[model samples]
Target: MRPTLFLICPVLLFLGLSYLLPFLGIVQLSFTDPQPGLAQYRHVLSDPLTLAVIWRTLRLCIIVTVVSVGCAYIITLLWVRGTPVIRLLTELCIMIPFWISVLSRAFGWLSLLSNRGLINTWLKDAGLIDASIQMTRNEFAVVVGMAHYLIPFAVFPLATAMRNVDERVLTAADGMGASRLRIFWQIFLPMTGNGIIGATLLVFVFSIGFYVTPALLGGGQSVLLAELIYLWIFQMPQWGMAAALSVVMMIAVGGILVALMRRNAETAK
Candidate 1:
């Protein structure tokens, strides 16, 4: 073989052996465990608890994806439009969150969202509310932490797309008497469609697989599919069930990606 093939061979071999083999094993186990049939998949799909968790997971992922993309778009706009100081500060704010450990970020939010924590205490002392609100161990807290963690993933792709948008086009439109919102709707928004799609997919996929942040924040009442998978594997030692859920997650993610790619391709043509 050639020199490039020789260089790539070890990495390919490692991936096949380490990653592919284990995934194939999981797939096999999902099918063959407890007598060869589709019982595991049927259980996952038909069980009320499993179905509820799936719905909750999808809902949370959708909310996180939308919120993260919206916030990232605004941040990108600010980064692009602001002065040197504003730009520097925005960059720092966006980058700093990614620098911290995600677990630390989750814990930080846990503290801030707790009843006696900063916000509630200040609110009560200020008489903003009659009592301390339920903040931590809830859906609200999960979304907040997940959004914070995923914002950087959303920002980079959006910023890249927004940067490629021609300011000269917007300036020309302004000279022609177009309003800012009109300019964005007619010109900028259409231009950044690909980036927006990419960022949405990235955030959604990451949110679905998320474990620590949601587990810490979502409480017992709001168990996500990831948590359900964890419960099966570690708590109950139901390997077949865990493997089945994993397969479903993989299939869902793969289907989304395939659809996105096909849509992008058709749009390109």
Candidate 2:
């Protein structure tokens, strides 16, 4: 017991100093404004710009979560049902995109989606549109960029869950005259329910706090919470406001984790 406690104490101390200490300080800063109180949290509730950014952030997160997870689910199904060689090749293809730095990925999208981009060039040649379509510096670009980074993340949790699903059960059902659709609905989906929930939670949490992808893709237009916090601190030097924004982000992500864990626990039964 003494040895175990000694081992845990240092880890606990480190967490306290790193995460807990800074968080508590921020909470204190949020309250003790120019003076001290609940003003900072109130600002979170009342400020129009903050509210708008938070709302847009939430909207983007929901759409990204749905699209990315759905895409991953389909890809994972194909992976699980494929031959070993096919699976290996597919995974290699997916991981190739994953290995590239995110910044580079965003830039790649820029080349594809810009006004004079490859897509527009092809479209113009094919008479799809009379002029080059502008896809950069807007909500469209933000979602595209975010979804690119998020898809791989969505794939792993979902594939792990899908992989763990008992294939024999589905096979047995098919042998007994069940249709593929029914078998997938009845057996496959339920077994992987926890993974779906987990992946959605993980993706949503990351999406809400995402900065780089949206910052580059959306320009300054589609400002999310993380970028808002960054703007407050670096661009505007609003330290007090920045600390308050940071606390809000922490709380929001923590809330996502709590919901994810609760759903997971319920599914365990």
Candidate 3:
């Protein structure tokens, strides 16, 4: 025990200096900056624009979570059930995105989805429409970009759950004349419930904090909470408000994680 404590001391010390201290500083700034009171928190919670941004963030997060999880489920299903070559291709598709930077990925989506971008240009050449569709700088574009980024996050958890399913049970179900769709709906889906929930929550949490993709794709119209936080800190120079918003977001995320932990513990029991 003494040796274990000694071994972990450096890690704990590193975390305290790097993470915990900075977070505490932010919390302190939120409460004490400008004055030692809850004025910043109250203003953030009560302000109309802030409230709108909060709602937009939550709404977009839900949409992105659903879209990402749905696409990831299909991809994970293919990855788990496919042949070696197919699995290899799927893995490449998933991991290639990770190698690319987030900024690059957002720009790539912009190139494809912008008004005069490849998709619109191709559609025009094909004479599908006379005018280019307004795709970029909108909620749709933000959702597409966010979903693309989050799909990989959703896939790994689902793949783990899918891989753990007993193949013998599936074979037995097939032998008993259960249809593929029925078996998947009843057995496979239920077995992967935890993965689905985990992926949804993870994606939602990530979407809430997304800044760049939304900033680029949203064109200032679809501003979310993170963007609002940025605006407060840099543009408006309201450090206290920014810190308060940060604290709020931190609390929300921490609450979610705690709930997830409790749920996992219940499942373990």
Question: lDDT by residue for model 2 over 209-262, one digit each (tens)?
Answer: 788889888888889988988887788876677788788878877887897798
* Tens digits of lDDT, candidate 3, 182-223: 999999998887888889888988888999999998889899
Report the C-alpha displacement of residue 180, candidate 1, in angstroms.
Answer: 1.4
RMSD list, candidates in order? 1.9, 2.1, 1.7
Query: Which consecutive 10 residues in model 2 have the weakest lDDT in total?
Result: 31-40
TM-score of candidate 3 relative to the true fold: 0.94
Maximum-lDDT candidate: 3
List runs of model 1 lying over 4 Å from the truth.
1-11
Which candidate order results from sorting by TM-score in descending order? 3, 1, 2
Model 3's alpha-carbon lDDT is: 0.92
List per-prediction Cα lDDT, in the order shown: 0.89, 0.85, 0.92
Q: Candidates sorted by lDDT, descending order?
A: 3, 1, 2
Candidate 1: C-alpha lDDT: 0.89
What's model 3's lDDT at 55?
Answer: 84
